[model samples]
Target: MPDECVILADGPAALVELCGISTLERLLRTLQRCGITRAIILSSSAAEIARRLARPSWARADLEFTIHERPPGPTTVQQIVDLWPEAAARLLLIQGDVVFDIRLLRTLLAQTSSAMLIDSSAPETNRGKLCGAALLQREWAVARNGSVESALLEGLEQHTAEALDVANQPLYDPGLRRNLRPICFPAPALANKQAAERVLFDSVQKGTLDFPAWIHAPIEKFLLRYLCRTSITPNQLTISWAIAACLTTIFFATGHLIWGIVLALVVGILDGLDGKQARLKVETTAGGKIEHHLDSFFDVVWPIALAFHFYSSGRLPTAFYYLVVLLAGEGVDGIAKAIIYSGAGRLMTRSICATHRRPAKYLHLGVGHRADSWSAGKGSNCDGVVGIDDCCNRHSASSTDVDLAPKNTLVDQLTINPVGLVLGCADRFDEAVYHNVVFERHAELALEAAAYALFHYLQNKRLGNAGAAILSQNAERNETHCANFATIVEQLD
Candidate 1:
């Protein structure tokens, strides 16, 4: 909420590019996110830097930039002070030699009284250094002592991720213990851009990931390094994947199911990349809202397209595909996620559904449960039905049918909540990651669709929220190894 900011863009590293944006622009964006609408930048080439900053942001139409020519020092600082608005209550001082995490600025801005940003990391060995940024009283003159109250920077030295620090650190209440911890910083030096880029890219990853996202991460980042350098914007990246996903309709309608599925999976990778790039570049916009509608559009379109294909082929159980498309597709599930998240304040979780009892006998078929597969049958369709082997036998193929897929098939995994199979199967090392969602078996397929509805329709569903759930069968499915998002849970309680 700081309205006025003075950024020292004349510094040695100010104009240097890190991950396609200059250090100065990164400083401005940090201000942008903090709602600092008025900025005065100090740089010898101020006009040039200002020209590069005309890019659009959804929340930043009110943001204004002005430039003063000089290497910032006493003279330039005084000029900025003279030009500072008379009615402004405070001015935020910033150094433009490094890239900062926005959470760091938020921590600073949340302060009730102005204080200088301190490098409290090595206070013992460090004699003193100048403040990196500060919120100052607008009626400013050089402090005779050049002194400002120090707000302590607190976080575990062992923690490297900025988000972990931002999310996990506790700020105790007091006039002063009220201070929140700042997150990561990497100087934008020529020798350091690669490491800075890595740190920035890694910062955008969520605390939790599904099996698919975890497996896809390496390739995603590998491609992102080049894509970030291109002129293609995040919205364009979003549009590109959406168009590619829409083409899946063509593939499915034309009897090119393999291409359709392949393109669909690859679209998942692009979908993730667009979000990362948007965060990395701080380019949140109305286009982001568009991304969601496009996602919903494709989510419905692709399934309908598949239904069209199945219907045209005159296949058995074509009605089932239509039911799945109409019922389990995007819009309803997305609404479920929003409602659950709002009520529980728990993200990346599922709604209760299809409460059917598993046939305890064929548990290996993902009908029965494992120890980690936490729950009593949900109170819906699953409320009373247990030991459904009679039903399984009535509908399912022989368990030993060799014509069907082996346990690792991807289609079976996708169709049903494969957590049980993956947990119990000996072949499950990467089976959780690589299994297909459908099977080749003629008769067993019926049970797969039914169980998926009975189990995964809303039960323990983990799609969307950009894979914010870690996809575990246990009650701890929302938890992660590093307790990365432990911050939110603690704050709520």
Candidate 2:
């Protein structure tokens, strides 16, 4: 509703120093409290704050807020336009030096014009006047490829004649124009529009307003361009990133917290880049999937192992038990995937002729759920039922069960026991994270089977000599930890 606004506080420490500590703090608090929908602040300090506050967000919608640390020069305007070309809305450009009564902000919001304010203190007394504040109209700027700054200059140049209609014709002349007009404000003046501008000027004179590290942002873009080249493969990049993650984890675990944290940060950055690089490079493969799986697998193990090592050294049983349950859950989940896929294959070969045949069989065999057969009158078919589709079931045996299914006899086709499926699912869940949607949709049923299997295995493992036959039977039934391929092959055959 208020359009797009940028609070451009461009100046050396002088402008910042002018406002002093109290003034800067007030400005930060006020700007944050300001109800503007999109606020852009050009400051290194702002960037630091934003980074420090970054966290995983599950927002229904995303809002873009950018803070640019403008380099010294008149060209700072160009930098802003480059950042947001399509945001042709209004802009509130606040100079670092100009402090104002909150009312001035209210008045600026109300104005429809491309406007600037006349600092009540003219510092004709000073070297440069307060050309700091401006109410920018998007349409007025030169939008050469949507450059808002150019649009601002263009609009200002074109609309200079119209400036006299708004405020103080006597104080601000077109002769004072460089693409903006000055709007005069009266005091009891709730803010520092006067001293603030001077601070900015002084900082500029001192040269403390250094260029930002934002140049790294374009590094992603550049890598994006490199990605356009036909050389890199996503799997390779993923493997590289995985190696980096492993190294980072090792470093962090081995008495090097600072270096490890730094490496961890790099790991995070590269972790983000690997995917982006993959997208940019247009490379995707089964190996990419393998890489993803490995990444997630390590993500679960390494962190917990680190915590375990730390806790174990301190003799903390609580952490050990908690991590054990988590590891148990992960193992359960992984094995569950293998079982579900295997069972899915078996059911596909069924002769149910009924509409609910396949997934009904899957659900039954999956978690030991009773047959949920659809009535013949129901319009839905087996195809509509989820988690039991032929593709998934058929594919299962190809990967996990290929080696094991052949030598063994098919004990029961379309077996409605969900025990294996349940155990497999439970085995694969690492204990660190829980209840994520990705797990819910993909891992739950499998985990159920895994939990069942681990229990069965542990029971056999416990019985020692007496349970030898049971252990052998269990081992023969499930040779691999994950047997999805076996399931797929069995179903297909």
Candidate closest to the true structure, highest lDDT:
1
Steric collisions counted per model? 13, 58
Residue 135 deviation, candidate 2, in Å?
1.4
lDDT string, candidate 2, 50-145, tens digits: 453254221201334566665444545556565544856766666543444332354344343455544434542122233345666555443433
lDDT (10s digit) by residue, model 1, range 314-400: 874565566575866555878986775333311111222222333213212222123222122222221012111112222333221
TM-score of each: 0.58, 0.27
Superposed by TM-score, candidate 1 places the C-alpha of residue 1 at a distance from the truth, in angstroms, of: 2.8
lDDT at position 486, candidate 1: 6
